[model samples]
Target: MSQNLLIVGAGEFADIAYEYFTVDSPYTVVGFAVEKDYLTEDEKFGLPVVALEDSVTRFDPAKTEAHVAITSTQLNRVRERLIKKTQDCGYTLANFISPRAMVWRTAKLGVNVFIFENNVVQHGVQIGDGCVLWSGNHVGHQSVIGDYCFLSSHVVISGYCKIGARCFLGVNSTLADSVTIGADIFVGMAAVINKSFEDAGLILNGHPAEASRVSAYRYFKLKAPT
Candidate 1:
């Protein structure tokens, strides 16, 4: 019997995965699953919607594997939540590494990973499970990317860096060698991290504007006659 595949979340990413599954993959996509609150459509990508809570019954894991297609736009919270949910329901998360992706033989990859096209995972690097490495990114040698991390496109992670779990590295971001990014941190797009980021919060790119608050307000047309 052919392997059954169920994709969680029904959005743009799901659409991409569905296309890949239909054309490139050998497994059949049985349905889409989502949380009760976010389950909007009766069907997605032309496949029936199966609630994440009842997915195991609707799609048997023994015959089917599931994948979480939630975009990592907001870090790992969305993907992580669905991963735990599907796993707890006795379903295994499937990893989809596009055949077009260039991954070295020595590179280590964990389960449920989504690696898109034109991405390069160099030798000796370790990517943990539940991670989403978007298209066009370069992960350098010996880098340790923790579980549940999300890396957007065109990002460059230099050699030997440690990226913590649940971290969100935005598009075009670059992390220099040996830098340690703490868990739950949000690195904005185009940010260059030359040093370690130990704090876990929003770290926007570029330095703060030098102009004083009042001066900046007036310059931006925010100040009005009182």
Candidate 2:
């Protein structure tokens, strides 16, 4: 039986989630939900868009599951908050692991994970709740990805590494073996993290990644849309 799903977001990521879940997974995306203040349209992707505050009432958590499609905005605080709220509403979060992705049977994953096509998650890997692994990434053996992290396409996480909660690893970023990334860190696109990062809230960039003085908000230009 195909499960009904409610995606919580109306933006780009939500659209992508809808496409993947509908075409690749067994879940049928029934509708979308966002905060009432942020809702600009009544429907998206040919489905109804409900305010998140009333989502549980409309969809009924007993009949449908949810996935929060927000990215690592506000250093992932927004995603984390929304995820918690969804759980509090008694909705079981749905995980969408692409049929094309290669994930080891022994790999443990928490709820609401979105693993895209061509990704390889090796044995002993532990992925926390609400993490999104974009296309073509490779998570090596024994790696631990914390909750709510967003890893963009083609990122590589080497063996035994520990990625902290709410971190954003940009496209083509590579983390060396056994490296421990602190929470809320943002690694820029194509950056190579050869060493462990102990400090939180720093933006890392360049070939051999170095911490930048700018916060994630400034580095990613979150305050104003580009």
Residue 201 CA displacement from its true place in model 1, Å:
3.6
Weakest 10 consecutive residues of candidate 1 by summed lDDT: 208-217
TM-score, cand. 2: 0.92
Best by lDDT: 2
> What is model 1's C-alpha RMSD?
7.2
lDDT of all the models against the reference? 0.80, 0.89
Q: Estimated TM-score per prediction?
A: 0.86, 0.92
| Residue 20 in candidate 2, Cα distance off native in Å | 1.0
Best by TM-score: 2
Error of 1 at 83 (Å): 0.3
Clashes found in each candidate (C-alpha, N, C closer than 3 A): 0, 0
Pairs clashing within candidate 1: none
lDDT of 1 by residue, 74-161 (tens): 4566787788888988887788888889999999988789898899999999999899888999999999999889888899999999
lDDT of 1 at 52: 84
